[model samples]
Structure formats: C-alpha cells, structure tokens
Target: MRVVILCGGESSERDVSLASGSSVARALLERGHDVVLVDPAAAVPVLAGPLRPGDVVDRIAVGKEPPSSSGRERLRSRMHAALTGGPVLELLRGAELVFLALHGGWGEDGHVQALLEMAGVRFTGAGSAACAAAWHKGRAQAVLGAAGVPVAERVLWRPAADEVPQGVKRLVAAGPVVAKPVADGSSVSVHRVDSLPQLAQLAAEVRSGEVEMLVEPFLPGREFTVAVIGDEVLPVVEIELTTPVFDYAAKYQPGAVSEVCPARIPAEFAGRMQELARRAHQALGFGSAAYSRTDFRCDPSGEPMCLETNALPGLTAGSLVPRAAAGAGWTYPDLIQRLVDLSTR
Candidate 1:
C-alpha cells in the first residue's frame, strides 16, 4: 500500500511530529509499503526518499524549547496553499492511507482531518469531530465527566477577561492548580500555580498572548497513561517525573523522566485505569477502530483521575503509547503495522 505520512505542521509540536514521521516512514518502508514523508509547513513539501533509521535525527531532533514562532505565519500560509492544491494534496489523494503523525495545532485539532474528510480520503486516528473534542482539554473533561469518567475540576478562562472565572478562583483556593492552553499538546506553556499571585502572573502573561487557558486543581499523585488501539487496551505506563511538572522539557529531553511499562501497580488498579482510559476515549466519540492515549494522574484518595485524551499522540521513540504497546508484546514496527491495518478496516 502507498502511504503519505503527514507531519511537522506549524504547531509547537513540529519537531516531535517530524521525528515521528521519520520513524514511521522507516518502519513502513521496512514493511514493504511505499511511503512518502511530507512536512506540510515547508515552502514546498518534501517527498523524501525512503528513510533509514536515525536518518533525520539531527535534522528533526526536538529542542528543549519548541520552535520559535518567528516565521510561522509565513509557513502556515505556504502550508495552506500547498494543501489546497499542489503536490501535497495530490499525494494525499493518491495514497491508500494518510498516516497522521501530526501532534498539535491545526494538524491534530481537526482542521486537517476535516479537509481529508471532505476530500474523501482515509486517514489514521480519530475523525474530525472526535479530534476537535479531544483537542480541547476543557471540552474533553466535560465529555468524559458526563460519561462517568473521573476528571479533575477545571474551568475555561479567557485571559482577556477583567476577572478570573469563579471556577478558576475556587480551584486556586482549594490547592495548587494547573494552568494550560485549552487546545495545546506536549505540555506547551503548562504551569502549576501554588498561589493566587502566581496565577495572576500567569494570567498576565497569557493575556498578552492569544490562546485561551484551562485551570484545574493539580493532582500530586503518580502519572500514568493508557493507550487504546482499536478494542485492545495496552498495558499502563507510569511516568516518573524528575521535574516539578511534566512540562515540554521533561517530556522531550532525554533523561528528564522515566517511564515504567506495565506500571508497578496492583492488577486491579491497572485494570481500572485501562477501563477508564477506554471510557475516556469513547466518551470523546472516537470510532471503534480509532486509537487514543488517555492520561491519568492519581488524586488524594489514590483513585486515578482522567487528565486528557490525546487523539493524535506522539509516536517518538520515547512516547508513552509505543511504550505501552511494547508492554503488550508489540514491537515498534508491529505497532505501526497494527495502526495501518486498523485504519484500513
């Protein structure tokens, strides 16, 4: 089968997406599938040759900080032109499947999915509606909470508002709170506020920016993520963070954190986490064969609370979903093959 792997859009997670695309392209090539890797943000999309292991390591290595927004608008403009009608669109339409290795921004937030849907193309991962719902942390929590999935108390706040939302104020008063962009991934600009003053500072910073934010009570418990591929729920992966929060640096930088697959928790608790992960995925209206990674952080009572669902999670060497898949007895290539098979079905 011919596959077009889309990655590295004008998002904060661009570097991560590029790394994922390189890895996926190599795996698919090894599996005898024709693969073309394209970074939509490029002035002219590159249909690179078959990728070798570590071929793009230096070129696409994630930095401690996300790519600067210096020329992002120009890149987005080029991306828009290319996707609308050009080599990229033709490639997408011609491929048997378009593997979305995209992480955040317009790529993973449903815009690209919607475009593909309109063009009648088959793509891996969730549908546009599901992606849209899952991309917004506040909305996903509401959907999951309504479906009986436990979630942290959160409120959506527009930084431009004169006063903080009442719900945010209440959460802040309760305890340390987490403030993050409502629709971003990879923990970009995510912050933990221990006091109203800290929140005020964060609010001021965000107010000068454009993104809306979500505020929620921070859970001090262990962090675990469960990946659901089709009907199969992979083993839980526990994240041991060395930093105060699993921010962008801790997430992408090597040695900043540790991931333990088949987490060293009781079988019953693991099973419960798996079930909640599945519930959270389905609560966002993901298709039966769609894949997602649902994140959880334990609360004061030791019960896990759903943090968020990643519709298009990272597929880098250190990503949690692949680690969970490994615990489930699937190799990296096998996981990629499984996703291709599931998407085709």
Candidate 2:
C-alpha cells in the first residue's frame, strides 16, 4: 500500500509528531509500502520530504509551521483542509492510505477525524466523537464512570475569572493532588501537587484558553498504562520515573525515565486492568474504530484506578503505543498498517 503519514502540528506535541511520522514512514517502507511523510501544518514554500522507512532512495525532511491566525475553529478548518491535502491530495498523491500521527488539541480531538470523514479518506485512530470524549479527561471520566468503569475521584473545573472553587480547594485538603487539563493528552498540563497552595497556583496557570483544570487526589501507588487493541490488551506498561513526577517533559524527553512493558504486576491484576481499559474505550463510544490506551495508578492490592484514555495514542518513535504494539509481536510498520486497516473497516 502506498501511504502518507501526517505528523507535526502547532500543538506542543509537534516535535513528538514529527519524530513519529519519520519513524512510521521508515517502518512502512520496510514493509514494502511506498510512503511519504507530510506535515499537516504546511502551507506556503511547499515543504518537501522523503518520509517513511525502507526506501533505497533519499528522504525528504518533514516541516510544519504553526497557524498564526485568529480563532481555534478557523485554525481547525485550515488544519482540516491542510490535513486532507497533506495526506490524500498533497503528501501521498499516489498513495492509497494515510497514517495519522497527530497529537493533542485539534489534531486528535476529532477535528482531524471530522475533516477526514468529510474528505472520505481513510486514516487511523478513533472517530470524531470518541476522539473528543477521550481527549477530554473530565468528559471521558464521566462517561466511563457512568458506564460502571472505575475512575479516579476528581473535580473538573473551568476557572471562573481565573479562580478555583472552594469545593476544589477542599478536595485537595489532605495534600497530594494532580492538577491537569481536563481535555489534554500526552501528560501535558499534568502537575503533581504536594500542598494546597501549590495546587491552587498550578490550577491558576493551567486554566488558560478553553482548557479547564482537573483537580484530583493523587494516587500514590504504582503507575501503569494498558494498551488496548481490538478488544485485547497488548500488555500493561509500567512507568518508572526517576524524578519525583512524570510531567510532559518526562513523557517525551529522552533519559527522563524508562518504561517496563508486561509490567511487573500480578497476572490477575493485569487482566483486570485490561478489562477496565476495554470497557472504558467502549463506554466512550470508541466501538472498535481503531485503538486506545488507558492510563491508571494502581494500589498494591490490585485495584486499578482509571486516569484517562488516549483514543489517539501517541506513535512517536518511543511512544507507549509502539511499545505495546511491539510486545504484541507487531513491528512499527505492522502497527501503522493495522491502524489503517482497522480504520477503513
């Protein structure tokens, strides 16, 4: 299959997206697919590239520039049009499919999916509604919890004039809070709070734009994330952070920490986590569109608490999705192809 991989956006995950695009492109080529990596954020200057792996020929570098415009919706439209062209029309002019590597914000929150749906093009990951539900931590939590899935106790708050509610203040009374954006992924806007003052301060800073702050009591047990594909858990991945916390920097940055796959958790516990992950995915209306990964902080006794779902899990060179896919005996190329197949079907 001839494929175009879309990566790099104005989002904070642009760097990660570019790396993911490059790696996926290479992997696709190795699997005997003709692939080109394109920057969805590209406009003028006609960014060029020799993307994807397995090419005996030279490759083009992927380039993307941010939208320096007015509202996010407008930018989303522009990005949507660009993504349509960036893959089917521009990037993979002769290709048969596209591999989406976008992360965060509009990219994964259904904007891109909606755009692709309009274009009648095939890409990977969850649909627009599922993407929206999963991208927003608060919404996903509510939807999943209502469906009888176990999630953490958290107050999702959008600042009223940059102030947090008294209820939110009381929730973190005992100390150890995790302040994060209710609608963000890839650990962005996620903070660990040791005190009320710190949590309040962090909340104020994160409550910008339309982004709301999610204040929840911190779970201090082992951190594990389960990757679910086609109703099965690839493996449970345990995150080991050398630092006191695993922030955005720690997730994408090299040397921050190491991930242990097939996590050293009990078999029964791992199975339970996988079941919960699948239930969360389905409860959010994902319905086998593509795949998603569920995060958790489990207590030693084996009860796993849900964090959030990445309906469009990151595929960066060192991303958790790839790690899980690898454990499932599927190489990077195989994963990309599988995503395309799953989405198309």
Candidate 3:
C-alpha cells in the first residue's frame, strides 16, 4: 500500500512527531511500500537522499509562515494541501492510507483525523471523537471509570481568577498532588506540588485562565504502559525514568530512561493492566484505531491503577509503543501496516 505519513504539527510535541515520522517512513519503505514523510514544521525542507527510497518516497512539508498568522486555518491549509491539494501533492497522490505520526493538539487531538475523514480519506489510528476524548486526561479518566476501569482518585480544577486560591486549598488535601494542564500532552507543564504553597504559586500563574490543572494524589508504584492494537494487547512496558516518572524529556531522549517489556511485574498484575487498557480503548469509542498505550502505576500491593490513555502513542525509534510492538515480533513497518489494516474499517 502507498502510505503517506503526516507528521510534525505545531504542538509542543512537534519534535517527537518528527522522530516518529522518520522511523515510520523507514519501516514502511522496508516493508516494500511507497512511503512519503512530511514534516510540517520543517515545511519546505530539502530532500537530500534518494527521492524514492527504491520503493516510493517523497519529502513534503508546509512552507513556514509567520507566527502572527499561524492560526488553525493557516495550519489546516498547509496540512490539507499536503494531504489533498497543493502543487507538490505528490505525497498524497495514489496513497492508500495516511499513517499519522503527528502528536499533540492538531494531530493527536482528532483535528487532523477529522479533516481526513471529511476528505473521505482513510487514515491510520483513532477517529476524531476518540482522539479528542482521550486527549483530555480528566474526561478520559471519568469515561474509563464509568466503564468499570480502576483509576486514581482525581479532582480536576478548571482555573478561574477569583477562585484560584480556594481551588488550591481543596487540592492541598490531596497530598502530593500532581498538578497538570487539562488538555496538554507530553507533560509540558506538569508540576508535582508537595504542599499548599506550591499550589498557590501555580494557581497565580494561571492568570490568563488558559491553564486548567488536574490535581490528584501521586500514586506510588512502578510505572508501566500497555499497548493495545485492535483487540490485541501487545505487552506491558515498564517505564523506568532516570529522574522520576516518565515525563516529556524521558519519553523522547535516549539514556534518560529504559522500558522493559513484558513488565517485570507479576503475571496477575500484568494481566489486569492489559485488561484495563482494553476497557479504556473500548470506552473511548476508538473505532478502527491502529493502537493506543494505556499508562498505569502499580503500588507495592501489585494492584494496577490506570493513569491515562494515549490515543496516539509515539512511533519514533525507541518509543514505548514501537518497543512493545517489536517485543511482539513485529518490526516498524509490520506494525505500521497492521495499524493501517486496523484503520481500514
């Protein structure tokens, strides 16, 4: 199949998306498919290597625009053009599927999928609704709980100027609360506040009301992630961050962390993690999704508690999902093809 990988949206996770795009492009080409890698941030990037990769290859990206004019419409035009319109639309021409490596807001949050769906094009990964729902941590947790999944006790506080201090008071009792922005991903602004003073300081910084934080008790345990593809739970990967929990830095950079597959946890605990992951996927209404990674923290008791569901897991080299997929004996392109197959509906 001809696969056009759309990657590198204008989100904080833009760099991670590029890495995913590079590896995905490599794998797809190796699997004997025409793969075009497009990085929107590197819009107008020059292709230095063989244009076709001996299979079919093209490097396409959006042209750089001034930040002042960089609205969603501006982005949509570039992305839509790359996938559908534009003169160098060679990437999308005759492409059977758009395997999205783009992460964060525009990509992972369902906007890109929604656009592709409207264009009547089939792409890999979750549909618009699932992408949006799972992108928001608090809402996804609630939905998962209603579906009978065990989640950590959490309280989401949408910040407001007048009641900011009061919200801090409520969050103070959570004890070692993890305060994080509601809609952001990759732990961009996540803060672990150990006391009320820290919470008050953070609340004051939410001056513009853009950052609504979710405060919850910090679960103490080993962190592991389960990757779900179709109905198959590949394997659990135990994330051991060099510093602390898996944050943005640890997730992308090498030497900062290690992920051990078939997590060293007991069999029962691993089974529960996989089960909760499956439930989270179903509850999110991810029809024909390629894959999702569910995060969990297991206490000393060996009981797993889900943190959140990642509708769009990283695909770059050394990413958790790809590592899990490889542990299942599927190479990069094999997993990419599988994801495309699942998205075919």
Expressed as tens digits, the lDDT of each residue in 197-293 for candidate 2 is 7865765664455667788877777788888776556888899887655676778666678898878878888888888888887888777657888
Model 2's alpha-carbon lDDT is: 0.71
Residues 1-345 of candidate 3 have per-residue lDDT tens digits of: 767777776776666776677777777777676666666545562122222446544333222221222354565566655555563354444568777888887798888778777777778888888999999888999999899988877777766655644545665765676778778766666777788777767777775655667777676678888999988998889987665455676665557787898778778877878888888888898654557888888655757788889888878767888889887888777887788778776
Those runs of model 1 whose alpha carbons end farther than 4 Å from true positions after fitting are: 50-59
Better of 1 and 3 by TM-score: 1
RMSD of 1: 1.9
Q: Give the clashing residue pairs of candidate 3, or none.
A: 20-316
lDDT of 2 at 263: 82
Tell how far residue 306 is off in model 3, in angstroms. Answer: 1.3
* Whole-model lDDT values for every prediction: 0.87, 0.71, 0.73
Model 1 agreement with the true structure over 1-345: per-residue lDDT tens digits: 888899899988988999889778877876778777888888658758444434442335788998886777987887787778877898899989999999998888999899889888899999999999999888789899999999988888998888888888888899999899999999998899998889888888878667799888889989999999988999999999987678999998988999999999999999999999988888898877689999999998888999899999999877888899899998889999999998997
Q: What does the lDDT come to for candidate 3?
A: 0.73
Candidate number of the best lDDT: 1
Q: Listing every candidate in turn, what is its Cα RMSD in Å to the true structure after a full C-alpha superposition?
A: 1.9, 3.8, 4.3
Candidate 3 C-alpha error for residue 292, in Å = 0.7
Give the worst 10-residue stretch by lDDT in candidate 3.
60-69
Q: What is the lDDT of residue 234 in candidate 1?
A: 95
TM-scores, one per candidate = 0.95, 0.86, 0.86
lDDT order of candidates, best first? 1, 3, 2
